[model samples]
Target: MNNIVSMAWVKEHMGEPNVVIADCRFVLGKPDAGREAYEASHIPGAVYLDLEKDLSAPVDEHGGRHPLPDIFDLTVALSLAGIGNETKVVAYDDQGGAMASRLWWLLKYLGHEHVYVMDQGFAAWTSAGHPVTDEIAEPTPVKFLAIVEHTMLVEMDQVQELLGREGVTLIDSRETPRYRGEVEPIDRVAGHIPGAINRFWKDGLTVTGSWKVADEQAERFADLDKNRELIVYCGSGVTATPNVIALQEAGFTNVKLYAGSWSDWISYSENPVATGDEENA
Candidate 1:
């Protein structure tokens, strides 16, 4: 199945016994704003998942701003949200699919293959006259046994080892300004990891904020060799999942996420940071 699904697909399958809808809206700074918005109104039967609370672990010195949650804990949370191993999940968010993609990636990493990000997100659903409700859903929790796909993840140490190595590509998913060390509003450090190329994750979407076609996504990464290893990261790990999906859509097989990302890279004082346009570096 494709990584993205349409609003029509979601509307059709929303209430099915094996179908689960997840509302994953979140803001970067305002942690509570997502839950508030979800309470105000959301897709009927959609269970809310906060980026910081449900999707990430508590921050520490090493694991970026939003670290990957513990495997067992994450599976339990998914089970509580009515997602089982066999459930077909469709996640939607108002933030241009970033939060939704995060959930999609997490599910895939946990060896769940039937998960997708709802295209164009919640606003598009509402604009298209889909039914929504403020009443929270009470889905029956089920057992979700996770079989982690260890190959989908790349640790900081692995990333450090692969820096400047042949047949490996590190993609920094931040915007050009942040990647160039011009302005970093989030992380302490401004520059990106040394030898990492910038591939602003938002570029995977069109000007109107919808995900581009597979060919278009392919064109965006045409400069890189598809056979080589591609490791993608953002400030933390929340935003990089979209690029991971995009790369997969573009037919890249050897792709992984540097979950700690730039925030964790700078945690070690000895790690090198690079600034300015270094696409070929």
Candidate 2:
């Protein structure tokens, strides 16, 4: 399956045992809001997975916010949702791919190549006049074999080592204000890593809220060699996923996501921070 799926495609494949539509809806402020909304209305046979409960484990000072969930737990959750190694998973959320892309990335990390994100997310699904339901279908569980792709993830030390390095690029997926240190609403630090460049995650989306065309996405990183190592991060690692997807859609293969992101970088007082519109690296 392609990395992006449409509402029509999802509708056509709904309820198939080989397909799973995961409603990865989430609202950061109102943590339970996504689940409530999902309960109210969701795609038929769509299983709701919360960002807090299913996608992330308990965060600590060192792990930053939205730390990656335990591999065993994630495997169990996917298994309970009836997702297997062969399942073609379709994930979506209302807030672009802010929440949905995490699932997409997670599935890829677990060596599931048959995963896709519903382009434009649940809003596009509903806007297309597709069927939604309050009924929750519980499919029988199956074993999920987790083959971790360790190369796709990076820690703070590796990121630090790559700072200002010639062969790698660090892209910050936060908004312009946060990236420029103008305002920080979430983390204690208001700046970005010393060598990172700001690429707002929304830039990857079209005016209609769907992902940009392949050529448009490709143009974002046209100056860089596609094979060069690229690291993407945002405030808490969650928002950075859209950029990761954008990079993939752009045909870049050596992309890595900093799971801790800026929050983890700032957790240590000795770590450096840069503020301004200029290229810090």
Candidate 3:
């Protein structure tokens, strides 16, 4: 149930009778490449979750890339994966908690509390000499009941209210270029929300592309009081989950994801955007 499970911890837990391993490897370029990799070879008993097909709703330019899947649809997908209320879900991918965190946040959004994202993802697992198999896992249906927690998500209105409240820390998890409005490769807009601090999500990872130590990560987010509420946002809410996971791992007891993120914020005519590296607000 911890926000981030290190590669070592996952190796120890592999093949445990109660744990469910999910391969969430995804490539934005070849979108279907993740499923292909999963089919080629994955951890034994691991289930493949397609980010485009299984994890996201239909994409349009307006929806931003990898928009969230319907809540009920994702619930059905989890249920079909043999992930019941009691299952300890372990999600991982080649990318450092990028695609993997999507599944992690999805589980939390759906109110399943026993899920963890594998730090460093499958690459670390394979490099650690862990076992892998190509054989498919047969379906075993399980009961997954969602107790949705609305507070986990913050909408534009909620963000407005939080800005009015003093000492609110809003973090933008995009790269510095995107955060500075220097270059926008994905979304139509270039700038970030006014008054948000730039904390590139990659900063949470080491040069090896694995998550940093808990103490180090805690230090990165130490500017915000752990007890006070913090809001994390990124391009379309997909990438920000890593920051949320990192903050939670860092001992920030109260953190929420702005699911709509910069894209969603700009979608509305009223929300403000700021340019340059200077911290707003």
Candidate 4:
């Protein structure tokens, strides 16, 4: 009974013993604001996960803003957060799925499959009439061991190989505008990697903000060749997880996320970048 649970399921099981809920509510404006909000109010048993501080690594000139943290450090922090191997971790955030997917992908990278991003996150959780508590719950530290799976991640070399091979689909999860080189928000380069298709991550969610059902998701992605190799990317790899998670829920098994994503691709300057209404030309 403990796979990915919906907002309804979270509501039904709030305050249930041993249930570890993480408040991943984050704001790009005041990046530390999530921790501040957790200090102010959260679900009774929820723990705070700061997107900038706890979730991602320090920004360097190479990795852009949210680089992946060192595995050892992240595992220790997860253990300190009371998430053990067996603990079911549920992540949530505002702006739909952005921050939550970062945590979800990190957990998966560590080879823990018991974690999930809560559908709709705090907005849905609050709308469901769930009580918010000013009190924070302190729990004993649990051991979280890292077992990294290299295959779950894709690097630039692999992407280059895939580009050469036929029957491979490269998906860019950024919005149409960003993918089309309309604006450059975070990175200096606006357009996506060359030959990548656009499928914005926000489209994975229903209008109500929850993820679409499995059947609907599967049907939506049916047009894409499921049996062929599929790779997903986004700016610095933060927003790509919604599309990755959606592909998984859609029953596509051969999905891989480009961890370095467009940021790394653009860094080389030698790598090709296509722009402006160009469809795989």
Candidate 5:
């Protein structure tokens, strides 16, 4: 199934027995903003999922700022959101799919294959004259068992081992400045992982802010070998997911996410960092 769905498709499938819409809007610094937006107005029958609470675990010294949520806890959250094993979930956010793609990646990592990210997000949905509701949805709770796709993730240690390895490509999905080590805003270290290439996640979108078509996505990464293993990462692992999805859309089958990402990479002072567009050996 395609990783992204359109607003019309979501609108068409609303209230279906097996279809669930999730409001995943989140502001990085404002913890409660997403829920507040949802409470103010959202797609009818949509359930809210917080990026920090439902999608990620508490931050620690080693793991990235947004560590993957505990599998058991995440499963329970999904169950409470009325997402069964067979449910078709559509996730959306106002942050250019950054927040929603995190949930999409998490669900896929948990072995759920029927999930998708909605295109253009909540703002487009609202601006296009779609129905919105202040009333919260009360979905019937159901069991959501996680099978766990371990192959989808790569830890910091695994990332270290893959450095400079042939047939493997580490992609830094942050902006050019961050990748080049020209500025350090969020993390202590500014440079990217040694031997990694830059592929800003936002480039996957069109000028109008919609996800690019598969052909367009393929064009975006035309220089890379599709057969090679592509491992993607961002500041805290949240933004890298869109690049993961973009790679999949571009017909790359072998892709993985470095869940700990740059934040975790920088935690160990011994880890080497590269700067200024140099893919250090």
Candidate 6:
């Protein structure tokens, strides 16, 4: 299936055994509110993937806030949710694919490339007049085998090398406020990595909440040399994923993600932090 599927496409093939719909709605403020909404209503056969409980591992001083969970633990969770190696995962969320992109990236890192995020997410599904069910989908166990692709992840040392290195593009996916060090909401450090460019993840979408067309998305990166090594990161590495999708859609290859992102960078006092309105530096 395509990386971003339509509601009509889902409605047609949703009942297929290999098809698995996953709801990834998450609100940072109200941690459990997403599950509550899922219980109230979701697309039929959609299983919930909690951001903190499922998407992230135990946080510590070394790892960022949303470290990748253990492969064994994630595999067990995926098995319980009926996600096999061959399963086609369709992930969705209300936040313009912000939350759902985490699931998409995880599946890609696991070397399972048959996963996708719904454009406009649950909002589009409901807007299309699709029926929602309150009944919880029964867990159908499947043997999920995951092989982590290290190419999709980068460590602090690697990031350090890219700080002033040419031929590489480091993208900071946080908003202008955080990137500029004007406001410190979540982490100890308020600024971004030195020499990184700010490209807020939400900019990949339209005002209507759906992802921008590929050509429109390409325009956002027109200034960049596509031949360069592209690395994307955000707070805890969650929001940076949509840009990965956008980049891929726009046909820019050789992309990697700094999974620990700004959070992990700030954890080390030695890492220099950049602050200002500089979109690219």
**What's the ranking of the predictions by TM-score, best on top?**
1, 5, 2, 6, 4, 3
Q: Return the number of clashes found in candidate 4.
A: 0
The candidates, ranked best first by lDDT, are 5, 1, 2, 6, 3, 4
Q: Which stretches of candidate 4 lie over 4 Å from their true place?
A: 1-3, 278-281
Error of 6 at 105 (Å): 0.4
Write model 3 residue lDDT over 1-281, tens digit each, in one string.
Answer: 46777777777887776788999998878987888899988988898888888888886544446677888888889888988888899999988778889899989888888998887777677888988888988658787888898778887778877774776788999999999999999878889887788899999999988778889898887767776778999988878999998888898867888877888777777767788886443
Global lDDT of model 1? 0.92
- lDDT, residue 267, candidate 2: 95
Q: Weakest 10 consecutive residues, lDDT, candidate 6? A: 272-281
Model 5 quality (TM-score): 0.98
Candidate 5 per-residue lDDT, tens place, 17-60, comes to: 99999999999899999999999999999999999999999999
lDDT of each: 0.92, 0.90, 0.83, 0.80, 0.93, 0.88
Best by lDDT: 5
Candidate 3 regions with alpha-carbon error over 4 angstroms:
60-63
Residue by residue across 1-281, what tens digits does model 1's lDDT show?
69999899989888898999999999878999899999999999999998898899999989999999988889989999999999999999998889999999999999999999999988888999999999998999999989999999999999989988999999999999999999999888899888889898999998877899999999999898988999999999988999999999999999999999999999999998999888663
Steric clash pairs (candidate 1): none
Q: What is the RMSD, in Å, between candidate 5 and the native fold over all Cα?
A: 1.2
Higher-TM-score candidate among 2 and 3? 2
> How well does each candidate superpose onto the true structure, as a TM-score?
0.98, 0.97, 0.92, 0.93, 0.98, 0.97
Off by over 4 Å in 2: none
Clashing pairs in 3: none
lDDT of 3 at 188: 80
RMSD of every prediction? 0.9, 1.1, 2.0, 1.9, 1.2, 1.3
- Candidate 5: where are CA atoms >4 Å away? 279-281
Candidate 3: lDDT over CA atoms? 0.83
Clashing pairs in 2: none
Report the C-alpha lDDT of model 6 over 76-173, residue by residue, as the tens digit: 99999999999999999998898889999998999897999887888678878898999999968999888989888889999897777879889888
Worst 10 residues of 2 by lDDT: 272-281
